[model samples]
Target: MNIDLEDELAAGMREHTADLKPSADLLDRAARRNRRRTAAMASGTGVFALAAVVAVAMTALGGTPAAPPVEPGAPPAPELLTVAMVQERAVAALAADDVQHIVSTVDYRGKTEHGEWWFDQVTGDSRITRLQAPGGAVTMDLWQLVRDDKLTMTQVFHDDRSYLVLERPLDGQRPPGPAGSTPDELRAALQRGEGYTLVGPEDLAGRAVLHLRFDFADGSDELWVDAETYRAVRRETVKHTPDGDARNRLEFEWQPRDDGSLKPLAVKVPDGYTQRQVPPVDGPM
Candidate 1:
């Protein structure tokens, strides 16, 4: 029985075993499944690589970067010279101009005066005419002339025939120190910025101008300088006095002749007018 047991088991296993083969359709289905799995893995890898590249690009380009923080009560950055350095340039330009023609209007104490002035830088010659309205009516007309450093004043009455002319000496007398009258003086005053400040930019006579202010011991002056030419276009002065507040305004119009020279001005006494010669004053005219 022991000897027959091994052979009987072998024969029994052999009898139960049967030969089987895979079909063409089953093999085709298995190949298709393997290809789909490979394709899916490749697509996932490509998406990961694309995401990494996008992240790098954003970092290099500084996308959505944060701004620097500012400290409390910190002073602002310095402005460019175009805005702050204009005053100095204006002063220099005005000082360099040799000849000037000015038309001005003055309003003081409820009275208005219109004036015309011509100045010669080389010969120190000037002519000035003023038309004044005392009380809303044209009441007075004054003319002043300067030639070869000599000054004369003429006053005309209601009747043009009655006019008084007074001749005065022009020696050692300082010229009027209005904002635009003396370029050298104004330049010096502005250089000392202790009391000078730039108000801002404004429109004057249809042109861009810089508004500057100067505070002095006696009064304060407001000047409007052309932005492009650096010329003083307008000026206003307010003086403090015991009597009251004295205010003055000066407007300048620079007229250069076609020859690029100063226009000539002539001042001659009217016909049949009596001329009076008076002693010269010791002061400046």
Candidate 2:
């Protein structure tokens, strides 16, 4: 076409399209290049004029520029539980709460002893005063016979003259408290992360709790902690045996240091008592 004719045609095009606003996508692209967004296309009039020329040329060619390669923002990945994160969370939760060593519950096997029991964290000394023993309603004092630094893992009571004691192998390295004696002990134990698996969140009794599992060769032990405070709530240990599966369930309660939970550190054993060896209910060595 002749130069004068082309100039005249461009002038006519500008007049017809001058009032038109730039396309939303084109304005967005221009704004990005300028390092700041311009909500109103008119704010960048010079850039808009050039964009208008490109749009008119494309329209005449009967084709359009491909939409800016829109990259969709990827959704955030969900947090995983069976990883180190859970270990840190579980450890932190227990550390924030400060309570006594432990107040224990009864065994859940051959015989049931329903009462409250606790342990001494600093001394490794524990005592359980039961309102009722294996027999019926009567006061009973449960003690573990510890001689020197070794424990025979026997359950001995001081209330009755005749007592049944199930003796297990001596473990010199074992501490004084029962297996699930204290959350403080567990807080330290869980630092390894391999000792237990955070089974995930769960509902226990009527409140929310997190279930942590520790696997054994013959069985497994599961611990539940309060969902909010992350304190110890309950523990269940299952043993697979030739006879059957022996299960022991215990619920924990924590008290302040000066709550009279432990008044006298030393427990007095009865002077005379007959001891017998037999299988035990929910026994732990």
Model 2: how far residue 114 lies from native, Å: 4.2
Give the per-residue lDDT of model 2 (tens digit) for 1-285: 123323543454454477553343542353234322322444333233233334444454334444444334422222223424445666676543333433344444465555555565544556656656433454665555455665433344545565654344455554546665465656665675467755555556656666778887998878777655566777777888776677766677765555475653344545576766665558565
lDDT scores in order: 0.52, 0.53
- Model 2 is weakest, by summed lDDT over 10 consecutive residues, at 74-83
What is candidate 1's CA lDDT for residue 207? 68
RMSD of each: 32.0, 21.0
Clashes of each: 1, 1
Which regions of candidate 1 deviate over 4 angstroms?
1-79, 82-84, 133-159, 162-180, 193-195, 216-219, 257-264, 276-285
Q: Candidate 1: lDDT of 58?
A: 25
* lDDT value, residue 203 of candidate 1: 60
Clashing pairs in 1: 173-284
Estimated TM-score for each candidate: 0.55, 0.47
lDDT of 2: 0.53
> Which residue runs of candidate 2 sit more than 4 Å off their true CA positions?
1-83, 93-110, 113-115, 130-139, 143-175, 183-195, 215-217, 263-285
